[model samples]
Target: MGNFLCSSSVGRKLIMSLSGCFLVLFLIFHMSMNIAAIFSEDAYNMICAFLGANWYALVATVILAGGVIVHLVYAVLLTLQNRKARGAQRYAVTVKEEGVAWSSKNMLLIGFIVVLGLLLHLYNFWYHMQLQELLGNHTNDFGYSPADGVSLIRDLFAQPVFCVIYLVWFAAIWFHLTHGVWSMFQSVGFANATWYPRLKLISNIMATIIFLGFAVVVVVFYIKSICPACCVA
Candidate 1:
């Protein structure tokens, strides 16, 4: 098993698929949590407080980070192997119009965009919240308590530019996940002709649900802030 994971292409792809699936589930949970902030700041803050500076959350974070690292490293290795295998013949292949051709070809680009967005998000939220809690600062930009996730999100989205940027990032994430969710299954050999369409449909539904959950939070908060009397009671 260890040798297969370290040396086999199929094993590496399996690991990627497993990690990718776990991350997708995490994204769904995260988006749901963020969406709660739009409806009630206190609820969000409670969640932040619950998750903050805790040993369990820290352990989960470390495991998630390790999964990301392993997935990315294997992805690079797979790409390199693919490139070497296609050497001198890589560009000579005819463009084939197969199902999901476009997404398969652009997976790496989508992955890159997702990674970039995650970095920006970590800086904006995680660094301010969990990291600050771990560091014992416990105060955020709006002078609200670090556990006051409502204030953090509201203040961030109140800025027009940041809201727009966040929306854009969400859009990228939507696209990435739309492709990634199905592709992960495909990599694991579940995307046969009989199941391909169903898999794609499921992937699209999951992606849309996650995207709208996060997007609604940002859009609703931005609108509420702009028209406080109409929104805030």
Candidate 2:
């Protein structure tokens, strides 16, 4: 079955859709977890600690990594196939694709930016946090416990540059998810004329929620760090 799937175009797309769905769910959970920090530092840190360096967490991380790799690999394969099939079309005067969103056309580019952002994010958070704990360092270079996500957030967002970068990354995520969510359903055969619009609506709503949720975390922490008087009573 696995070999057959890899050999066929449809099977590879199905695999991409499945893995993409898995990662989408994880993003929702991750955004929710970060939202907890806005209301309660203890709750956020507690959740962070709960998910750090433990066997279950490690297993989940590995699975998540596998999904990302699979999705990316299939994406490249699809792009190459399309280019090869449409080699002549590349030079023809392109007619605009009516009703298709801009994101749909540029998914590959958006996906690449998203991947780069994820790498930067991992370097900023995962390496300093969970990876530290996994390596038996109770505290990071800043002397805060590796599980001390509150401290990490405060210090990291203190720099306006990083805040801006994160906001830009989140914007890229918005574009990616808007197309990705509905497109995944379409790939799995849910894109009939009637259902396509509805799925697109749902996709926009989800993409907005995720972007706003993540942006809030970065912006709020940055504000707090920049102006203690505004945050502190």
Candidate 3:
């Protein structure tokens, strides 16, 4: 079992699927919270306070970080192993492209782009919010306090450049998830002939929902920033 997990393609893909599914759940929770920020600042801040550097939340954060690290490491390892197995024939052409799409062929590149976006997101929000709270500095730029997540989000999205960058990052994430969600299931033996199309459709719907949920918050907040008079009485 140990050797299989360490050295086998199927085992690595299984790990990737499990970790990817875990992250998807996390994204759903996060997007829901972000959507709250759009309706009520106090409610959003309250949610943030609940998740504030408390023991359980911190532990969950650590576990989530570990999952991301493990998934990324295994992805790189598997890609390298596959490349080595293919040797000089890595670029050989194949007429049998019926089962493969562009994304399946470029998962690594999409994964890298997704990782880069995640790093930027972590720096913009996590470092300032949770990490600061953990270190006991609970006040941010607006003086609203560390877990004042609504304020932090509003401030960040108010900047035009940052808003544009975040939009781009979210776009990359959407593309990554569109392929990843179903592919994970396919890896775990759930994508037989009858199930493949259904799973792909479900994946697209899930990806679209997540992307729009996140995008709406960013775009709405940005618009609010630009036209505060329009939102206020």
Give the whole-model CA lDDT for all candidates, comma-separated: 0.80, 0.89, 0.84
**Global lDDT of model 2:** 0.89
Q: List candidate 1 stretches off by more than 4 Å.
A: 88-96
**Superposing every Cα of model 1 onto the true structure, what RMSD results?**
2.0
Better candidate by TM-score, 1 or 3: 3
RMSD (Å) per prediction: 2.0, 1.6, 2.1
Instruction: Quote the lDDT for 3 in model 3.
Output: 80
Residue 47: error of model 3 in Å? 0.9
Give the C-alpha miss distance for residue 84 in model 3, angstroms: 1.1
> What is the C-alpha lDDT profile of model 1 across 68-103, one tens digit per residue?
788777777888888888785556557667654565
- For model 2, give the 10-residue run with minimal summed lDDT: 87-96
Clashes of each: 0, 0, 1
lDDT of candidate 3 over 150-225, digit per residue (tens)? 7778888899998888778777778878889998998888888898899888988998999899998888888889
TM-score preference between candidates 2 and 3, better one:
2
State every prediction's TM-score relative to the real structure. Answer: 0.91, 0.94, 0.92
Off by over 4 Å in 2: none
